[model samples]
Target: MATTTTTRSFLQAVATEEVATPLRVVQMEGLVILKIIKHCKDHSPSLVTGQLLGLDVGSVLEVTNCFPFPMREDDEEIEADGANYQLEMMRCLREVNVDNNTVGWYQSTLLGSYQTVELIETFMNYQENIRRCVCIIYDPSRADQGVLALKALKLSDSFMELYRSNNFTGEKLREKNLSWVDIFEEIPIKVSNSALISAFMTELEPDTPVTQCDYDRLQLSTSSLMERNMEFLIECMDDLSLEQQKFQFHYRSLSRQQAQQQAWLQKRRAENMSRRAAGEEPLPEEDPANPIFKPLPEPSRLESFLITNQISNYCNQINGVAGQSFNRLYLMKALHEE
Candidate 1:
């Protein structure tokens, strides 16, 4: 029988749609991982599916005793029963699989860009930084190549247009902090739903960079934007307005490659679901809608934010910190990586 897929929202920041391109990167890695496991697959191999997949933990032993049994009903009292319960819970916790599969699920767990940043940090840490005997993750430069499973180009034009269609210049957006209100300051935040706003305000922990303080202080929750990380989110109108009159080739292709990668992930996920329904083994950790992929498409400078006038914004096209750094060899990186 086909297992019903989980529908709970796995990510807390950006919606699945917005970061679809990046998620494809994870999907490709999962496929590689699955293949690797199967390569060593012996019916009685060294690792069981649960061990490899990180799911086969100890079975549950729902309390067999009825009514706080062993705790004298009439003796309403100070027996050490509570202490025993706590000990048993601790034992169960110990059996938790300390494996990569469970941890990797969160690499693309949809904390929006927050988790993405952490994932990048994990894979990009290097031998030059710290040499070890274990397998080192591929460098950031090679991330897109490893994520061979995604076809993210199909939506490139649509998403690129999203940033482009609403194009506005940084000149229009006075040099101010990028708070939610400031972004939409041309329009103040208002709501007919207090509950959502209250919920949003509650979730705003002090974990983001100092720059996001304005958003942290503001009240927002039920808002449509709670799904997105405010830092990665640009002033849509301002982003387009600020686009340089000139466009570079690499940045353009990165945008398209991102779109292609997302498409590929979606296709693979559908097939995986079919495979599961046919009574094949349930696969490794991954959300079908997400496919857990991210293609490391590097951006070209000259075409994207690198304007002849030296104007720019850290753009969605490049997926890096924004600033004057955009001007440095936008074309060269694109040419080299492409």
Candidate 2:
């Protein structure tokens, strides 16, 4: 009871702190970093997710260890087994006096498709259980292009509340002023290494001479990335258009049904009035129209917003890759003229 009280008090204090100060820093150990990279590379094109073990000191989360969960088609079964495995692993870690608490989990993404429902569900689960949990995203595809992209993300307070309420209604979203950007906040990550480890790494370095023209990074090797991003963007646009068409169709159908209902009601009332004027019994004054056309349920706008955000991401990536290719072309032209 005392421990529970202490934890609650600590959490309350954290909640009272300025929302801008969430996740001040993420300190990742070298071994943990290597393990995550290796796991992601081994999976290659397939998406993989894993659990992280760490300690939270003040606002900084220190990740000391991690383990990858195998890729499986049965997500529901895998989730159950994953939870059991985490529990067992934490138990063993505690026996060895290692940090056993789960700070967050990591997922591998292809391009930027990690902005999907499954990923959001996982983040929500973690945040509900662990107040300061973060989702670390590792993009192996981008890494293969000479850019190692790892980002730490957590849901903002307003987004979290919106998710908890399970109400994705338009009115609620607008009232909260919530947008795609407000859904998640990226936290800065700092890799930490010890002096002994640094010394060992330095000793392991090759003694070969290095040249200054090591421009491998500037090579126009983004053809695959550019093609994929363009394809994905086009597909997303088609999906967005389809959703809009469905919404418009629903609105037109609703308006027509409403007009028919009004006509039916007016006709019934006029008939009853003529019967009464002729000293005949009038029909009951209850509604006589069918309830089948009562407005169809509103389609959730969550999917539309997600597709828009994804389209935006693809555009940004294409622009960046195109810029790099143009720079390389300009360099080649200058060299040829010279």
Candidate 3:
């Protein structure tokens, strides 16, 4: 088995090296692509959680920080599984055909509500040209999302780093000049999970123009109307989360986590260094035997950024795909009011 594995690895490397860059590049001409990310934070202090959306070439993505975790265990586990699966999807996109045509949407179902999976499936079937392109769930026929079905796709370590560029940060909203409605007509919203679709349709009443319904009647618990759906959603989330933590404990890295710890140590060192420069004594080192310095229940560093810049960019990206241009920050502000 070891010999065969080595042979396969060698062949893959050789194949990659032999293929010319131009030839290897996937030809994505008329294809519309959507990009999703797990951001750390958002513009608002109270908002948290990352987003999933389509990319806009002419403008940036509009992201927000409202990552609601799954209330149910099963739902949480699946989302955790989806998060890991996303790493591979990121890699797969690098070589595939890419174009200026992009759309952005956020995953707002909260974690674990396998209902979001239904959203994705719906989008896939909504239009002939549209593809869900999720990072997880390799086999459509499988009963459960398998871990091994994940395929490795290479991505640049610097991809997310590009958000820091002046263009991404400094650009102002081009408001009056932007037109978004033209692009909205192109998308086909497919429905795969009928239960979710029916539920949403029943709740969604026709209001204004013949356009799509953007607002959801999130009828709070005073009425039984929303109770059944809400309870189911939360339960799915909790289950999903537990499974995710289990997978992380079993398959995730010790070294990588340790390195995160090391980075924290370095940050503390810097804080101490500055204090010492100002004439204060630094604190004592953490005892190696103590478990106090260990990883905690806190969110990862990625979450911190997702809540802010990442969230804003994600939101704006959707506008670009919709053919409307707007300020990234303003989009989030507008989205919040609704």
Give TM-scores for every candidate, taking all chains together and pairing residue i with residue i: 0.17, 0.81, 0.19
Clashing pairs in 2: none
Q: Order candidates by lDDT, high to low.
A: 2, 3, 1
| Candidate topping TM-score | 2
lDDT of 1 at 290: 50
TM-score of candidate 3 to 2 decimals: 0.19
Give the per-residue lDDT of model 2 (tens digit) for 153-254: 877789778877777767788999998767767889989887898999889876765522234456667788888988999999999999899789878987
How do the residues 168-189 of candidate 1 rate in per-residue lDDT, one tens digit apiece? 3332223322211221001111
Better of 1 and 2 by TM-score: 2
Q: State the weakest 10-residue window (summed lDDT) of model 1.
A: 60-69
Candidate 3 deviant stretches above 4 angstroms: 1-287, 291-298, 304-310, 313-338
Question: Considering lDDT, which of the candidate structures 2 and 3 is the better prediction for this target?
Answer: 2
| Stretches of candidate 2 exceeding 4 Å from the true structure | 1-21, 73-81, 207-216, 264-293
- What overall lDDT, based on C-alpha atoms, would model 1 receive against the true structure? 0.30
Q: What TM-score quantifies how close candidate 2 is to the native fold?
A: 0.81
State in Å the error of residue 256, model 3. 24
Cα lDDT tens digits, model 3, 154-198, are 112132123222122211213222121211111222212336655
For candidate 1, what is the TM-score?
0.17
Each model's lDDT comes to 0.30, 0.81, 0.34
**lDDT of model 1, residue 231:** 35
